[model samples]
Target: MQRPAFDPTAEEVARRVLADIRKHGDKAVQKYTKEFNGINLPPAKFAVPREERLAASASMDLLFKRTASEIFARVVRFGKASMRKDWSMATPKGGVLGEKFTPLARVGAYIPGGAAPLASTALMSVALAKIAGVPEIVACTPCDKKGQVNPYLLHALEVAGATEVYRIGGIQAIGAMAYGTAHIGKVQKIVGPGGPYVTAAKKLVYGDVDLDMVAGPSEIAVLADETAVPAHIAADLISQLEHGTGHEKALFVTPYMSLANKVLAEMERQIASLSRCESITKAAASGALFVVTDNLDTGMEVINRFAPEHFEIMTKEPRRWLQKVKNAGAVFVGAWTPESAGDFVAGPSHVLPTGGTAAFFSGLTVDSFRKRSSVIAFTRADLIETLPLIEEMGRVEGLDGHARAARIRFENPS
Candidate 1:
């Protein structure tokens, strides 16, 4: 099936909103909040109150709190394991070359909350930044018409170590984080996923601050065979669609036509019971696709072309096929490992590359919150040994000063 066309208007809108925020700061943010989000919030009210965060935690269900804590622990464990370490190697001429990894001092995380409050997103982004030893993590999410964020979401942000919480979202939130307002401090980097407007804002603000990725709509591809459960396949497809955005893509590729038909039937049956059936129906009409291939090789070819954010292999030997997958933000092997596991507790951040960008861009990782710098220390002997090569290249490049600088050090021997 053909992919949906891009919307140029969204980009234009984001451009205008971002420019307005960059110039006017808090005033522009408040104006957009009233214009877009339909709420009148002053600069002082932009940041969520500390008492409200405490109240959310106090009112959260015990079971849900435990679950959130468990998910946070699992994500932290994965983040720590995946973190890169500083390393150095001795050179032959007694010089040392190495890379030093340092976490960004401050970062902003956007937790999507328009259609549904993505509480898990708080843990996914903030916990990883915390594990990377980031000093301050600011969180932003949209509030309801009542001017209150979801209790669960606020609790998650606090639990995940967000140093500050803001009740703003969309392009305005991205702008405020990128360019500091009187109410909000500028962050070194921005992480988390959002809808098209937020994605566009991130793109426009790329040079101003570092970004996690151009994460747009959610997408999933399922490669199944006779061994795959039709019900499970149907449920997974519907799950991706239920992200509440009609832009999500769900593709099913199978060699067995019979299994494909069964999964379709199962989807029709299961979607009827979903509370978000309207969203699922809209997404299915636009973004859902089913392709029946003659063999597994042809199916694999189709999967590579799409390069979905999440790829599920539910075949007899899922591992064997995994070796052939060159692109995908994340892969779920076997029937037991569902996409939901990776979304929630699988230890990897769900802020993955979308819009077929998995071919080049990678999902969010521990290193996303850190910066790496090459460290080089050269002795006089080392400089002398390399001077000829450097001087020759400098001269060839018409950089006489570069060659003279190296020559002066050797000539003076001071």
Candidate 2:
């Protein structure tokens, strides 16, 4: 089936919110925050106090704090490993050409706190930015009706090295970071995942600020055969469904008809016991797909077309099948490696491209926080030797000024 198009109403709402924020700054942001989130606050209350950040950190459960620390360490190691180094090469003309990688000056991380306080997101975006050597990392998240941010989220942001924290959410938070309100400073780029409104806001502000990706709902595709366990497949599908937005997608593709039927039965059985059974049921009805292909090759084709955010290979030869995957934001090699491992503490950022964007965009990485620039250093002889080529190309393009610039350098050569 073809994917559904984005909601026009959400886009229009986001456009209006962004325009208002751009025109009125802090006043507009406060108005929208109260309207959308039901939390009214003055401009001074926009930022979370430093003492609250520390208190949150101190109040965290000991076990939870330890796990978070371990995940942070793993993510940091992965970020450092994924970072690219600068290198230069000597050209045939004795010129030097290379790419210099530099971390962004200031960046904003949007942690989703509407449905749930995504403390892991603070670790994912903020920690990765810190690992990339970013000097300033700012975070924005929604608060409860009481105008209080979640303690776990506050702790996570502080632990991940956020330089600033804001108690704002939705499109207004995005606009405040992108356009810079009286209370919050503008960031060079914005990174994180959000609901439809947030994604639409990011789309509207693309040129104004750099974005990681237009991430939408969560999605997962599982490719399995007879060797795969029905229970595992069913549980994996239900896991993403429990993310509680009915927009989440879960697909199970297989060559064995019996396996497909068994997995479906298992899903029905397992979902009954889940706390979010209603959400799972709604998501399964709208977004789940079960395909029994002619063979493994056809199953693979279906998965590639979907290009899910998370792909799991549960075939007899899972490693061999991995070589054929070209799309997916992240891949799980075997039944032992579930998508949840990558979602939490697998050392890679769980903020992945969704809504089939994995076909073009990539998952979050340390490099996402850095920008690269091409450096060219040419000697006088190198410029003279390349002058004829430059002049000829410039003349062919119908530009006399471009050709004269190259010729002038030679005319006065000492």
Candidate 3:
């Protein structure tokens, strides 16, 4: 499949808007929010009130609320289990060496609500932050023309422990969080997957705030065999394609040309029933492909090179093929495991690296919500043992002061 061109225009627009928001404060945020999302929110009203969040939670159906609770429990349990713990090891010379993990003070999550409300994302992003003990979790999403955000999304955010929720989206929401406006305070880091515009805005503000990854539109790849169900493969492919970005990609790879043809036919039949059929059709035409490799081994090579956001292995032995994959945001093991399972109910956060960034970056986890600090407690013996090494490096770098500072401690014999 052809890699979509990174939007050059998006960067230009984001840069201008971020600068305007940085310099002009809330006024600039409101202007762009109205222009792009049609949400007419004032500075004070940018953040949804706590009463509204509570009401959203209350209004949800009892059965649906119970289902959401079950999913959230799994998400939180996984976060706690996966979180890295602080530990120390004794150094060679009676010194202490270790790492300490601490939760971030404040963070922002961008939930896409333009084409869909994405209630699942509320738990996917903010729930992990909550589990990581982030004191203030701020959420941003686009509101309707009347400035009303999705009630379901608001309810999910509330349940997931969002301390603040804002009715804003697009580059404006990113800009507001990255560079603090009068009302929305700047966050230490920003996370969650978004459309092309949000992705570009996050990139422009990299120095202004830390970001989870260069996450954008969704993409998927499937390494399947003749034994794989054509209907299952087709439905999984269309899932990522319906994310409303025409840039989304869904690659179907198989050694058997017959199986590939069947999956393609199934995609056509299944797409008409989807609400985002127009967007899915546009994505499939431009971004989808089927590669017939020489064998499954060669097919695995093609998959790793593509480095898709979500990868499914539907062969005789999915586990065996899973060992061969190198660059996917997440791997679904069998026909029973679909990408949607990971997005909605799986223990891990759905916010993942996209656009082949999985080659270097990993998906969001509890660790993403915390910062690590290297801990070093040096003994006198440790300082003396490593002093010569430090002196040699300092001498080579021509930093005499660095060496002298250490040498002076030993020079006086105290």
Candidate 4:
């Protein structure tokens, strides 16, 4: 397989797209959509009707309806458990300083609808917001050629407690959510992953509305040893590739070239039988690679440096080697714990940072849905105890008003 050293050009492209989104608004958005997505949405074309969204609730398969409900229930359970609450603690001097947690009043979630129907994403975002006590959750997605929202995606949003469903995509929807327009109300934060254009829009409107991390391509690193089965490693590599273009990378780092070749052969065999063979094949051939390391320690070092979105440790005594892993979006230990399991039914979030961003960013979690504020309270005793130090610091900093305020608190106790 052909591989190149890690590139930073992708980040540069993201910055340029953001500039375009800020300058031309929807006009620039539509042009890019047509050029890239091959879809032309005229002015006002992106808004999906409220009735259609409602009607979509009744149109999904019964099994999907039940599954969507279950997904929301799980997400809600996780989210509510971590919901923010305000708290204040008292000190001996009658001083109190604590923290308060609050949900953003409203949030906008973007669901990518170009190639796949991300029903799960809709459920995860909206249901988590609902559990966090967000007053409103607005969801947006691109429409199909027939001008209809994906039924399953709509159903998930409904189950997850979205207040409204908008049939807009690309920069226009992002702008509407960030800067309230006649058709769409503004939201406090905008989240979820999208194409380059939607991501650019989020970057452009960041100051106006908070955003999640700027996402990059998805990636996976497999730390396998001679004991690891080649077939399992191969299958996992293909699984990451199915996620779409610029969405996957597989690193096979081991001392044994024989084992790596075996895995590559297995990948080639499996790719031939899959329906998305061309994509998986090309992705595997290009994104997948084998690295010959001197030892497991060296392999672990390389994996840590990459900090892939998914890390699979396949070695004898996997648990022992697992402790060595310090970085990754999520670590799947042992042969039984496949990467695909983490993406869906494993109860952890599949929305992870990629392109080495996992070193700093975390996968979507309950923490994403809440914010905090510092809480402070002071009694007369507390004021008197700290007054001299506060006055001294304030005076040294030339903040006479601060010193006076502290002195006044001590002089005039409430």
Candidate 5:
């Protein structure tokens, strides 16, 4: 299917799912899972035993296990270093006010188990949560038709330090994790990437629990010039297009028509031999666009407007252009740095904002897993100093109780 342009209507649907889940928890979850995923495992399929989780990892090929572990180690290291300490500040009013950052006590990390199991996502989601100091991290992925979570995903989850792993997917898994079913417990927040239904569920459950951005189909935009290599541009475009068969858009912009056409031709030639050509074709049909600009600045302006999820700058001064880039989930500098580098082993979180949301939303990071509480310390001296102003402000706001409280504190000087 042509990846539909970023859909606000999908958010509406997600809101409905959230309401339905609240009204009828498991029943709604099961109904949606059965209708959408074509699976009916009931709540029994939710939990993946500790033994099974270990077995899943053990079953992996030695090399795969080694490589995944190494990657996990790097991610863990990054997570630890990314941890933020508590902070405070002294106010001019002699009052102390500041904020302390604490990891949520419990968190839910959703890993999409689509046709291609996202073992990498397991690593990203769980490792980040672990580093944030979450005591209980529950993970959920949908089971395949044969009723098993992909063993690789289970292994990744195990390595990433998931306290609880469930073989559930789609809106139901979300509902279960958010609402606490007979089998699954509620979580403080849910994080991951999935199809529209999953996005919808996250939207639906936002107030009940924290959520990441409402992600859309994957996208990559390349800013290339005559000096840039066509093959490199083609490869990068294909790399992103190969992410899925549906509407994953790839754009190549250049100052000259010749280079743009050359890159477009290169894409046609290179795409034919790719394993995911058919998928890429569908994605390209909706996702791909050729943007020709009179100059590099014009291209940069257009790119900033798109604010792609993945942006590659194939220019003479790639490093300089990095500063010009104001909106992007992740920026791939130069031809050598492809989006896939960031997708797998790059230190930054791959769970990024999509659908022009890079304008405001940020990619997943340690901050996403933590919450902040403002701390205010008012000494007797401070309270007495600010009392009149506080009382006047409260009175003007029509809060008699607030004004009285402030008045009492100053009047008694206790």
Candidate 6:
């Protein structure tokens, strides 16, 4: 009825590629890498050499280093503050019950390299894994025809603490990361964003490896009132369109038709000068939505139904209306805040859920790279007191073995 709830073409292709990789392993990965990226890389040269990572880091200028350092500080600070610690409480029976956070032993971060090299995404995704203390952080990005990744992206991956780097992208990268290959070992989890094909591949490989969310093409929505500036709203709407994928979406919902007309005029005036105007124009024409609601409250309801990845509140007293938001990956409050700020320097990871998935999924965070295990230490008193409850529940659930195990422990308390 709804095209199987995902892109049929994307899933069909991804299923074939993933099954190939699951069976053929490295050969299948190489085949798709050549077909998609147009580069034939042998398994021997699949990895980015350590020396290359160093060279990319050294090539960066002082200004770039300083900027990266500042951004990294913010990301690390937020990660540290948000990370949960091992905490416990004394139970009534003098037993210890708590949760211990354990970082995944290995995780893969997929960086998009097709449209534009997402250097910021390297920090947004991989740096958080580093903060979570993941022992082995693997990064995979597509290489150009010359078999080289963007220096900035490579450098950022190194700064973010990726232990292993691969020159592969698309379904192949997800396959290699999810299913172990001779070239790249399997990772316990896969994180980050990509295009439609990549997004579909991630969904297909869910049980094989843990995933962050359904993060695909960029999306943004703005809720505005009479007080908002047309120029700012137009610029913000166009920002998500320039992401190169035709799947990118932008929405502007406001109470004033006059503002809607003005924003559209501004977009027409501003888009001509952008470097990626050709793709942006095509994407905007097909994906952009401009709605004039009856009031600000109605405008909020429209954008919430859209469930955008980046939601902007540009109305008067933006913070006061923030409480009304029900679905959004991230919110940019007030006029001075732009989506680009969150894309680059903001403390939170920009790898957010897209394509209306914000209704169910959340953006990535430091804890996405870790596992939480609840601890239970039962004293004799606790076991004895809870034993009856366990036995009764087990019997009701048709599991006498569970009841016997606890009863046996007490029965043979030698």
> What TM-score would you give candidate 5 relative to the actual structure?
0.92
The lDDT of each candidate is 0.91, 0.90, 0.90, 0.76, 0.81, 0.91
lDDT per residue as tens, model 2, 337-403: 9988888888899899888888889999999999999999998888888888988999899888998
lDDT of model 1, residue 381: 88
TM-score of each: 0.97, 0.97, 0.97, 0.88, 0.92, 0.97
Q: Select the stronger candidate by TM-score from 3 and 5.
A: 3
* Candidate number that wins on lDDT, 2 or 6: 6
Clashing pairs for model 4 are: 48-167
lDDT by residue (1-414, candidate 1, tens digit) is 435323467789999999899999999999999998999998999989889999999999999999999999999988888888999998779999999999999999999998888989999999999999999999999987678999999999989999999999999999999999999999999988888888888888998999988788899999999999999999998889998778899999999999999999999999999999888999998889999999888899999989899999999999999999987999999999989999988889999988887888899988999999999999888889999988999989999899988889867465
Q: C-alpha displacement of 65 in model 2, angstroms?
A: 1.1
After superposing candidate 1 on the true structure, give the runs of residues whose Cα lies further than 4 Å from its correct spot.
Answer: 1-6
In model 5, the runs with Cα more than 4 Å from the true position are: 1-24, 93-95, 412-414
Q: Model 6: runs farther than 4 Å from truth?
A: 1-5, 412-414
Stretches of candidate 2 off by over 4 Å are: none
Error of 1 at 202 (Å): 0.8
Worst 10 residues of 1 by lDDT: 1-10
- Overlapping backbone residue pairs in candidate 4 total 1
lDDT of model 4, residue 228 = 91
The local distance difference test score of model 6 is 0.91
